[model samples]
Target: MPGRDETDILHSWHRNADAWTRAVREELIESRRLITDQAIVDAVLDNRPRSVLDVGCGEGWLVRALAAHGIQAIGVDAVPALIEHAREGGGSFQVAAYDDLIAGRFSQRVEAVVCNFSLLGEASVERLLAALPSLLEADGRLIVQTVHPLIACGEHAYVDGWRMEAWTGFGAAFPAPAPWYFRTLASWIGLFATSGWQLCELREPLHPQTGRPASVIFVARR
Candidate 1:
């Protein structure tokens, strides 16, 4: 069972699904417009995988993008509403939580598994890494895009811990704020190594105009 913090994080997404979908699709956020979305897509395409699994895929944007390139992509998310939206967007998607994926609920191992700004906590990272061996084919790759830990740390001291999303600029549409655990860059490297994943490439997606890193992309091999 998820602890209080995990529960809150899940609930926040469930409640704010619609708003998030709109924000992402409409490009209301600067990060998506400048770096996040395209960066993730580029990383996936560079791998040239025949099939990809999009874990925690929200509204299936990445899946749709991948399909445009003629790549087979499957999306899975915990929120039923988001899954429904993803289907409406014309992509294959299923309602599955992180735990469900870890349990091999959705069969068919893929050449690549991509988590786009979806990994939220240390426990989740550990659990997902534990399940990768079974879900990935031989020589499979894992790609992850997340808020740059340095940017996420912001004014706070550099450390690993839980940080509540301010939800600033999102307006009153968001009813609840989402909380994500902050992992330092070093912590991330160590975590992946201990989980039996070899760090292959670490790239920062820079804003087109400002040249500031908006997200960190990690490519690992099993």
Candidate 2:
């Protein structure tokens, strides 16, 4: 199977845009519906940010959610279709790539920058992280939620590498997934340090029924 790469991943998102929009809106994925979604929301809320920049905000779900808490949120994504869908749902959204995220001038620094299961590409994620300090307030936080390394590793080797994602349980509309890179726990911490971030906290939300972690949340500071 081919591994996760930039070209293939973006192409997959473009191809799967419609299906993904429906899936997110309808809560089709069991993990997101049961655990990861609320997990990320709660993590962001914990910081009590007045303004948040949601990186890779697909369909603007998180942006709308944060608005209910009176937090101003701006969502940006590389996919035009996803950004369009997000805007239709009512919130601030922009079409931007990883490079755009690093270079685009915002009106002001935000209190929190959240990446919810979206930092999958290796180089892009690293570069984006390095540039985030400049976009945040003095006490700002960078919140990242990703697949639990142990769980996501499945039967694969326990190292940093790209893997083919299977869009299981998302139904026939999604036969495959975009590129996803797996990072070990140590690797995650190292990435943060090298990207000019200090690891503040790590959270793993569990599946209530099985007690298995649904995803790992990393809260960091510059």
Candidate 3:
């Protein structure tokens, strides 16, 4: 029984899956093309994990990329359309929602769990973080890449709340972007601690032209 906001996220993704898939496959997003993509890959490789779980994997690009490095990667998303596209050309992907993961629907554990620009809901993300510790092995890591709070906090008070995404620079082919929960750096640290994880490393990949961080990466261990 998630709220309207959560449901709206799914609806928007379902509506935009094709366009999103094209964008990722075609490398249309400049931030991702120039910065964030390689940042997450390097972060995951630094751990040298044999296996990885990509939660909220859209179109399964990360899963495919991980597989290229000979690492086993499983991707899961709530959107079936996205999962379907992933299955067609990406690595192992399944249709899984946060509820499914929280409910122990998948017993397989991995050395690392990576969430790249996927966590968006407030209640859903909070509950999911609380449940994620169970999906890892001893000393497993969680690597999360997100829009830098400092940059995303534009014109708004720095606090925990939901924000609308216009997908402004993501090209005109995209549908309306969904609302995402915004968390400041301190709040992000608090969330990790609340979930019984210890923050170990932080990376801020910068956009070359702007010299501004494209995304902030958090590496934590359970």
Better of 1 and 3 by TM-score: 3
Best model number under lDDT: 3
**What TM-score do all the candidates reach, one by one?**
0.95, 0.95, 0.96
lDDT scores in order:
0.88, 0.89, 0.91
Candidate 3 local Cα displacement, residue 122, angstroms: 0.6
**After superposition, which runs of candidate 2 have C-alpha atoms over 4 Å from their true positions?**
1-5
For model 3, the stretches where C-alpha displacement exceeds 4 angstroms are 1-4
> Model 3 clash tally?
0
What are the C-alpha RMSDs, in order, of all predicted structures? 2.0, 1.6, 1.9
Worst 10 residues of 3 by lDDT: 1-10
- As a whole number from 0 to 100, the lDDT of residue 120 in candidate 1 is 88
List model 2 lDDT by residue over 85-106, tens digit each.
9989999999888887688555
- Pairs with steric clashes in candidate 3: none
Candidate 1: clashing pairs of residues = none
Superposed Cα deviation of residue 216, candidate 1 (Å): 0.5
